[model samples]
Target: MPTTINPLRYPGAKRQLVPYISKLLTNNNLAGSTFIEPYAGSAVVGLELLQKGLIKKLVLVEKDVLIYCFWKCVFYHTEDLCKKIEDTLINVDTWIAMKPLRDIINPNDWDILELGFAGLFFNRTNFSGILRANPIGGIKQASKYKIDCRFNKPILISLIKRLSHLRDKVEINWDDAISFMNKAKKDFIREQCFVYFDPPYFGKGEKLYRHFYLSSDHRVLANFVRQNKHFDWLISYDDDPYICGLYSGIGAKYCPFYLDYTVSSGKRSKGKELLISNLPLPPVDLSMTSSQY
Candidate 1:
């Protein structure tokens, strides 16, 4: 097994919910199955499964071009990637001090996004490491505040150990998720596959998060889910009227989940997220059971 790989380091990642998610899986009897993440933002949950040996393989699909390429590099060229970052920085001061160099790298380039080699050195030396910039089209702040990532020795060791196992089990896909799942059903006929969908939430301000995922895409995805009769699945999304309407009659066991709104106001809102599962989940009482350790 690989060392503990922290996914919370990524912006907009759901690392804080690892305990809840893992408990959800444990309740569902999902250990050792092939876990599929259609929108694998930062792969926090998927990576956790890998570390715990809870899943046999992680089939990840990310539409974001830069993020997808970055993971590909991590899986294929882990050591070279680390070396490039290391060779670029000597005592970590130069790594964190240079702002011009960080700005120079094009956002389009996967290398820039895969900053673990280059960016991680600087990210680690700062505050909370949120990598936050003002929302697009929003007012430009006088100065940028960063929650710098601390690339400490323990973290480096953990990353290296995990990379070895991750390089082999992680599979990447550039294709549209609906089509990919359709094809996967054919190949993995008898194999158990659990699909996790974390599509974009509606009505969130554009600058609040990445706007790459289009609203129309949800309809297409929901259509695919309604018609496709393949494997068991789980989907998480804002509990909006439109989303509820879409999942209606989809034959999923719907459950409500409260979303932690720590990003914007650092206050928990009355907002809710819906979890739709095609598989039947056991009646595990959250308060009474000590399932989530």
Candidate 2:
């Protein structure tokens, strides 16, 4: 919740692609259009764009109940969330106590908002902000970096408060991306909206993240984006052959680029990623080497 940039830490946070998104929005004359994000994992990109005044409004859709409820608590229960952060102890003992609160298997968003807090706790404390990954410095707590190394309460609360003020410009939804796109096709006017698909990675993504798409669902999403060329849309994924053929075979415009990945050890690694979209990309960026669909 620090940096006025991203309020949440995601293992796959697309902080690097913010520039690319901004350029696309400017070049396509869709600067003020309503931006839609189907997979709201950490919401790194959308919130960055909205906060920077690049987009007029934002719509965040996620099927995961815990993530959705965490966002709900962030925006709707702003004051209480702030107070909770202020009062909570940031230690291994507290981390152990909050484990069951955000179980992806049996996620409970309600129950006095402990689940919501648990979601935030895991996100900030876990390795690389991966919700399901092991706690930072391992459970043994001997890696020099303590559990609360990333949990800056005052800054987190400050960012959350500022973000909550933008509640009027943001809309959060708990639904699959495909369902949201279907409704969007009917409800949106085609010209005023831009959809960004940062679906789970097509390769190790399934194993790396809590929520992911099977092959069939990926195809369904690609089909929708390809068929709806009238609506400016962009999709990205870890560069994989199956994904290449799935979208490129269908004649969608493609741009192969790279986004950077930061491992839990603070080491930076590079990987080639693909950006498939109906809009003309500004240019391929190879920095921060690595999102969607």
Name the top lDDT candidate: 2
Count of backbone collisions in candidate 1: 8
Give the alpha carbon lDDT tens digit for every residue of 97-199 in model 2: 8886655544443563676677788878888777778888778899988888889888888878888988889899888888887877767774599988998
Q: What TM-score does candidate 1 reach?
A: 0.71
Note the Cα lDDT for every prediction shown.
Answer: 0.58, 0.78
76-97 per-residue lDDT for model 1 (tens digits): 7667655654555434345335
Q: Candidate 2 clashing pairs? A: 198-292, 199-292, 199-293, 236-292, 259-288, 259-289, 259-290, 260-288, 260-289, 260-290
Supply the TM-score for candidate 2.
Answer: 0.90
* Residue 227 local lDDT, model 1: 81
TM-score for every candidate vs. truth? 0.71, 0.90
Model 1 off-target regions past 4 Å?
1-4, 7-13, 16-29, 87-157, 208-211, 265-271, 282-293
What's the lDDT for candidate 2?
0.78
